[model samples]
Target: MSLDTPERLPASLADYQALAQANLSPDVAAYFLRGAGAEQTLRANAEDLAALRPWPRACKDLRGGSTACAVLGLSLDAPLLVAPMAYLPLLDPAGEAGVAAAATAQGVGMVLSAQSAQPMDHVRAEGSNCGWMQLYWLGGRDATMQLAQRAARAGFSALVLTVDAPVHGIRDAELSAGFALPPGLRAVNLDGLAQPQFAPLTSGESLLFDRVAHVLPGWEDVAWLCRNAPLPVLLKGILHPDDARQAVQAGAAGVIVSNHGGRVLDGAPSSISALPAVVAAVGGAVPVLMDGGIRRGVDVFRALALGADAVLIGRPVCHGLAVAGALGASHVLRLLLDELEVTMALTGCRTLSDITRDCLGPSPF
Candidate 1:
């Protein structure tokens, strides 16, 4: 019933959610758990993924099979990575450092959020494996470039530029709960940068259009970052095929099909629903990754069958972290990987490459 009860262990990823909710304050839980608006897209992410059925095979040679793969030239034990989530210190005292340690222990990569509660260098030092830094536009090019360069200096291997959320989503749950960061914990990585200031809006003018939209990054900015960044830039939050193509044209190293975990744009398509088209758009020019509603290992297989070269997990790992810090987070990953291997064995997929669209049947939906 409590985080200190180490004897009780979560048997499935879903179990961690309840455990986490129990461990966290009600307001904090709402902040971490809710999606934008009506949460239609949030529910759809899992629902649409469940609609696809795996075409199970009875027998195969089943020899020399492995889940190992590589993304952006970095080898991985499985096609899994931790999606960047901000303010981990709110979940546990160990914070992002614990998550990084957990990812390292599991032989997967961790993408540290620009809004991370821990300093980038300290978190990177906790993990020896691949680490990526997720970047938000930070109002303009100079500040953004400074953060990217800091990640490079901290030993991060790549940069994941989140392009979808130009402004924060209308998260009803967070608003209702009145969520605010507790004192002494903040986005330490963003310290010393001047926050963007906007001119006062005149009455009857659109606040979003008139004041906020001007600072948003554009295609030219993506190209600029790709050309100048010390690390390879992967554009996350891509859903539309045209945008995917544009990302590749902008010289991106990869594209991540995400709706910002359904935390942005309530009616937007789930990452799973959008993956196939994004994959086709890029046409293998760059790796295509996705993150949304990945609750089980079978979901990971389903994503691969659709087109994602790899997948990132967000809330479930946080759930684990809330329950028992690094050990719980690592256990969540281990459970998923074990389930993925089992699903592969049943579907006759010996390696990640073997998990093709053929491994799937028509959607039950």
Candidate 2:
């Protein structure tokens, strides 16, 4: 059931997700949808977000309300950013390039994955000045530094170091379906690069510590990256308050409170659940951002009310990409922004700042 031009664009984010699954092959859809282990965290991400209720304030001056915000000195039409998601080529041949063009045109920021289908320069050209790059600590210090330099040269304003996935998660759905990356789809930016590998697991040695641990970078490496990198470095995949504190101490310009979208460490806490603590831990030293299970405009308002500076939207954008390339992706963003503005207007909040904790249900924080 391919969505044609008229039917391709969805009126809601959830519709986009459904249409994307309908259009993509089962293998690809499973690859995109699977979460790690038993998926407790995956379910929890949406559940926790749903638990948050908004308190509507009626009868206020609603003449000239705007959803614009400034994050890291960059003006955004809405306080929404496209999270760094990999393998856009799997969704459409236009890949990250198409998504980048849409994001730039929509006046939102985008973060290209370290594992993006296109190279840094091409993605940057497509995304224009609003593009940021998400980095994985590849192999060792030198390769990581080289990637950073490349991104800097490509004019990425910020560097997002994804610290959660030192190794891929145990995705049960992908395993059950025997899903594999299709031929011709590769992380183009990492072409010709040597990734760290580990020896076969020895008897009695845990797969996590013995195999995965070998490639993981430590806190000192994170600190070194902060000092050496040319751009502001943000530590993504941070959940714990302590880790958030450590990231700030290591000179991280910001922290993205995420559980790797519940794709890593399945039983791990939901990102929204972890966000408040991380926000408290940072204590305003650095901006705290969050991602995961953001499906609606009210969810965005809830996230901000819960102390997040901004929120990154992931799966919905991918859904849009899968459905109608740039058109679908940009429309998804526009829908969210439009919905957010409506939520603001109805709630009597004229500005993003007016959306404070009091606007939400009683907070545990």
RMSD of every candidate to native, in Å, equals 1.7, 2.1
Candidate 2 lDDT by residue in tens digits, 287-355: 899999999988898899889988998988888888888888888888888888888887789998899
Q: For all candidates, what are the clash counts?
A: 0, 0
List where candidate 2 sits over 4 angstroms from the true fold. 1-9, 362-365
Q: Tell me each candidate's TM-score.
A: 0.96, 0.95
lDDT of 2: 0.86
**Model 1 per-residue lDDT at 134:** 96
Q: Which one is best on lDDT?
A: 1
